[model samples]
Target chain A: MADQPTPFERFIQGILPENPVYRQLLGLCSTLAVTNGLKPALTMAGAVMFVLFSANVIISLIRNLLKPHLRIVVFTLTIAAFVTIVDRFLAAYMYQMSKALGPYIPLIIVNCIIICRCEVCASRQSVLTAAADAVGQSIGFGLALCSIAVVREILGTGMLAGFRVLPASWPSWTIMVLPPGAFLTFGLLLGLVNWIDAVRSRKKL
Target chain B: MEQQQPDRRMRLRSGFKNSNLAQAWLVLLLALVFGSALAAVQVNLGHVIEANKVNETLEKIPELVFGADAARKLKQRQVPIEITPGTIAVEKDGRKAYYKLFRVTRDGTPAGWVIKARGQGYADVIELLIGLDDRAQTITGIFVLEQKETPGLGNNIGTARWRSQFVAKSTDRPLVVVKGGAKRPDAIDAVTGATISSRSVTRIVNRTIEDLRGRLIPAKIEFSERHG
Candidate 1:
């Protein structure tokens, strides 16, 4: 068995070493689909955070009772329950944002990030440890989404959260608002992160 | 391989088939508990979720049916009425179609009607709210409620510039979509790259206006004759 990570280390791990979107590459569908605009990207991240935190806490509480054969089914039910709550709440309160996100909200049930955490951390760890991991991974996912959105929104519409950030005379890159822009931006950012990691390793040597 | 009898009675035994029965029962228990939890949440929040949906569509009715000036004036006196197609007109398939219309009154006199319309577009269904003048002779305005046209091209159907062109457009003849320089009074300019989407909206609006006019003109005539 691996040594129990310190709470601080557990939290930081999601943001750096095992970032859900950037490092682990889980939940890429939402990462690519909603990151065209900042508001939607953040709102999606918020929903994921809620689901992850609640599912982790619940699974950790029931860890002992989980049967080997029924484990996958139980984990799915727990994650799905949290997802339904988030989905209903968003539709009722923030109707416009809910509409903007559309099918992506329901797609959270299959995000893989929440289920992976339940299997890897919550199934064996204390509730507090599981909660810490959920928070850390969610932050990591949020950072990755926001970074992509910042680049896409700024270049696509020359605006940030609906406010004009660039001069009117500056021509907006129309491609940046389309699917191709999402692919290009994510590719470059992934390459940049990899390069940074390589430089850091060389420095350590 | 070990030979095992395939008997239902044996399978139900706890350890008869290597604990498969126990695993099945455990899964069933978990399923029941979680399913009920989801059902409970749904029941508690069903009303609020439904109301939000109605409001999302209701809020757009006035803006689409009345011109900006009259719509604002009539906003304070908006009355939503649900109508069945059979009540309004004879139908081929009474079960297939239903219409939601809004009655706008000013100073206790009926001012306008906003009717919802839907039809297939280039990529998906195009839903719209179309306004008719009280006389039911001309279209007052139009609003695209929902569409799934190709983004950056067909999606331009929802732009303010495109929608604004429908204001005060005569419904005397069926609406037509034109390429450029829509010189004809009944012709509308199609979006540069979205001819099919623009045509779809025009076709839907025209068909809806024809269907509604058949039911409404007689109703208006009878209403005025009795009230005047």
Candidate 2:
């Protein structure tokens, strides 16, 4: 019991040690689908943050009441409701951005990251602890999406969010913006994060 | 194992009052609450969402009629562009397909025509607002209104460079998509690796121009073109 991590430690680990994308490999569908451009990736991250944080808080509050068999059902219903509201809001207010994101916003329901966090942290932990976990995981997810977007957008279009970051003459790599670019970037970044983790652990030993 | 704990706590013989026996009440409660929330959202925001789509197409009218740079100048100078919406039933292949038409005029003069057209693309329906000169003799521009084609490949149909091929091409001949560079008149170069998508757009534009040329001679178009 004494060796148990503090709530803050649990929160802190999600950012790097238990990153949903790189560390746990959860929510890769959106990570790959939206990372071709920076704007869409950021928008997706924002929506996910809102949904994940809200779901975590509500689930943590009602943890004791949750039936064992009906737990997954509740998570799905809650998430679907949040995602529907988000989709409509985006369509109404941020129409262009919503168009760019397309069906990916609705697809956030199946993102595994939120569900995994709910089961692992919110279902057992205090409300504050679950919230901290949500925030931390959201940041980690955002970072992962941003990194992939930056790499793909720069190499693919020689631009970031419509601004030309590279020279005009730069021949953009066609593959970088394609769906395969997502897999390529994900593989390399995953390797990089793992390698860094290994070095830090080896140093401690 | 966790399911057994609920059965031990059940005191009521009737299943309705007992929380453990009536395990699905929580789900029913959550569903009702969430469903109501969702219904409220849809009722309030649904119209705005539909309006957003219409407004998006309206905003693209300027760039579709005039060139992009000219469209910017028109905005700066406060040149009022009028878009009169009308629908035209054009016979496509074997069936009758209707296309929404926008007769655009700058101030009091007929500038060009923009037609809303859609066709089957590689993965999904691709909607385009195609622009043509007042006489419907040549294409002015094209703007993709909605598309869900393959990312990075078929979706390039929306890019300015690819769409530029249609501009100034004569309406006398149906447009043809070529493999590489299209030096021949009435021929468009296909988007590399997206031949199907490229062909789809070409088919849509060609079919639209052929059907519209004879039908779109508005009385004001000729009068306005001759005088101003």
Candidate 3:
């Protein structure tokens, strides 16, 4: 077996090496839905960070007490509670954004990344390790979402962050802001990540 | 064994540890803990959320009634008008519909009236803030307060350009939606590929004007009579 990975490795692995969005492909529901705009994507990242981190810490604390059969229920209840807080917080403080994101914020309760982390890492790992893993995975998810958002927003509306970056004459690619655009961008980027990984491994050998 | 064994309750504690019901007890305890935590959050943030919804409508009042350009000019002078909210209940065919509306006043004279309304759209209910002129004979502007229509298609109903079609439409007759077939005097161009959303918005605006036109004119006439 490979040498045991410390908390730092787990943290770094989630960032790029084992990115939740690009490599693990967890939580793609949010990644696809909110990546049309940079603002929504970043907001989603902020939300996922809070929910994932809290859920991980709570699960790690209760790891010893959780029954094997009933653990999933406990994890879901904890995650749902955190998601509700986030949803309400956004509605209170950031009304426009909350309206724009609508059901997507509440939808985070079912987001695979949080539950998967609880089951795989937080269930057995130390609280510190689980916390680090949660942060790294969320950051990786943010990066993937932003990368897709930047491309889509630029091509879809000839703008970046609501400012026109492309020449005015550049015809907007309306399809890029649609759902198919998310799939296309994700597939191409996944292929690109794989290609780079393949070359790096070949050099190492 | 102890000289005096405790009651069955004490023995059951040890027995319960190995029983299947142990998990159920743990689940119940966790539910109680988490339920209270969620209740705390709702109580803390609920009012803020309510205020946010109200503030959004209040802030859009000027732009909804005076046209965007005039609203901007009014804001440059630090929003001189005071908006007082009131209710208008219109009965049709033995049914009552109550409207929460605002009277925008500057100094002492009323500037306009803005009403909150909602109607079913293609996906979900679309909420709107509709503005009317002083006499309520024509629409000055409209703003989509909330909608959950299809993204990139039906959602165009909220765009300023699409909503502008509702501006300056007379209340004398109901507005009609046209899908590039014919441009009549009272026809609004339905958003391409989103006729349902366009139609729903038209229906809502038409209903608002139809219900309030005569009622508002009579109220304003009374105010003018007193000042005349």
Candidate 4:
């Protein structure tokens, strides 16, 4: 299509227009599941970013050798391999965090963000471009997760990263820590992003 | 010779209508190669994974048996475990669930017992470690090992505030879960939205204590006394 965007533009695009979570809606399962607290949300984001970066670099380097008929198969195999490495590494090094994450780490195998990046960008672009996109999209996805976690943790427990934020006099909202809270906060944040975009486009016109 | 037909060369073509055997073989080969690579990694990391798992359990033992502050006291002491030959059976919903009990000693003296317990919770089997005092008369602490309960509701059983209720609870009678509020020592307040899970945990802890007390504790006490 058009000439590839500069790396800076690509990074910006990932955070706004083509965000894997909020804009593209690629990896909603994890986006919703792990954002209840700061630690889990951050860990999930790191795992996704690592998988995406590695998979993109490798896939782009070998894109020419990939046969059209076997492209999806190769992509999945590569993604699964990277995911396992991350899972084992976490279990060994960050034992408690690995335990806290539980099944979510292994579930990264099926995260659509990494697979989507491989198909859309990595397969068609240079290694450098693919790597840039991976980093950008990962930050976008991580930001979305962190935003939700910040709200939930503060409102639900009156704490942020285990430190008290709200005054003790303020009544904590217990529902904010539950499953429904995830949906409510995410929905509101998505709407806010859309609203801001609408205002920016109108000003441009 | 004129009547004999010339042999025509067959071109291998892969298209939409025709199946591509070469491509199929390539896909299979890719899968096989990658699968072997994954297997190799797993085999190499197998020991590390096993050791981490055992360490995870060992690391939680002291904290589960003692409060956070007191758990550090166990650092210098080697916590020896003595496993019992038989398992304890507890009935819930017409099914018999079995639990294993282990005696935990601090420096060759009996200090406590950590029972590996399980019960049918709301959605899945809840596994936990129940730590009891030396006499097996009071529960020192409880730690949930594994659970597949409802995320926001039943899963709250794993939180510290919920588990702390079991600390120093006497095991003379079966513990009960109270929905409104726990008014007595033998009763625990059920999690706000997860009555079934809270009840299940209490029942499992109570059953383990009942089954292990008579057979294991008295014999161990006599052995420790004679050794002293």
TM-score of each: 0.85, 0.87, 0.84, 0.83
Q: Clashing residue pairs, candidate 2?
A: none
lDDT of 3 by residue, B1-228 (tens): 564366555656778774567877777887898889888988998989998877888888888888888889978877577777777778887888878788777656778888889999999999999999877878888999889887767888989999898888888889999988536768899998899999999999999888787786435322211110
User: Which pairs of residues collide in model 4?
Assistant: none
TM-score of chain A of each: 0.97, 0.96, 0.96, 0.95
- Runs of candidate 4 with Cα error greater than 4 angstroms are B1-33, B63-68, B76-97, B149-154, B179-183, B217-228
Expressed as tens digits, the lDDT of each residue in B92-149 for candidate 4 is 5687656565556655666776678888999899999888887778888998988888
> What DockQ values do the models have?
0.52, 0.74, 0.57, 0.47
Comparing only chain B with the true structure, the TM-scores of all models are 0.75, 0.80, 0.78, 0.75
State the C-alpha RMSD over the true interface residues for candidate 2, after superposing those residues. Answer: 1.6
For residue B85, give model 4's deviation from the true position in Å.
9.7
C-alpha lDDT (0 to 100) for residue B221 of candidate 3: 24
lDDT of 1 by residue, A1-205 (tens): 3797865777899998999988999999899999988999999999999999998998889888787667888888878888888898898889878877899999999999999999988888888999999999999999999999999999987898889899887677767867888899999999999999999999999
* lDDT of candidate 3 over A1-205, digit per residue (tens): 1464668987998899999988988898888899988989999999999999999999999898888999999999999989998998999899999988888999999999899999988988889999999998889988999999999888887888778899999877877888899899888988999999999999999
DockQ of 2: 0.74
Which tens-of-lDDT digit does each residue in A1-205 have in candidate 4?
A: 4686766777788987888888898899888888878888999999999999999998898887778877988888888888998898888778878877888989999999999989988988888889999999999999989999999989987888788899987676777877789999999989998999899999999
Better of 2 and 4 by TM-score: 2
TM value for model 4? 0.83
Rank by lDDT, descending? 2, 3, 1, 4
- Angstrom error of the Cα, residue A102, model 4: value is 3.4
Off by over 4 Å in 2: A1-5, B1-10, B13-17, B20-22, B69-80, B92-94, B106-110, B178-196, B217-228
Whole-model Cα lDDT of every candidate shown, in order: 0.80, 0.87, 0.86, 0.80
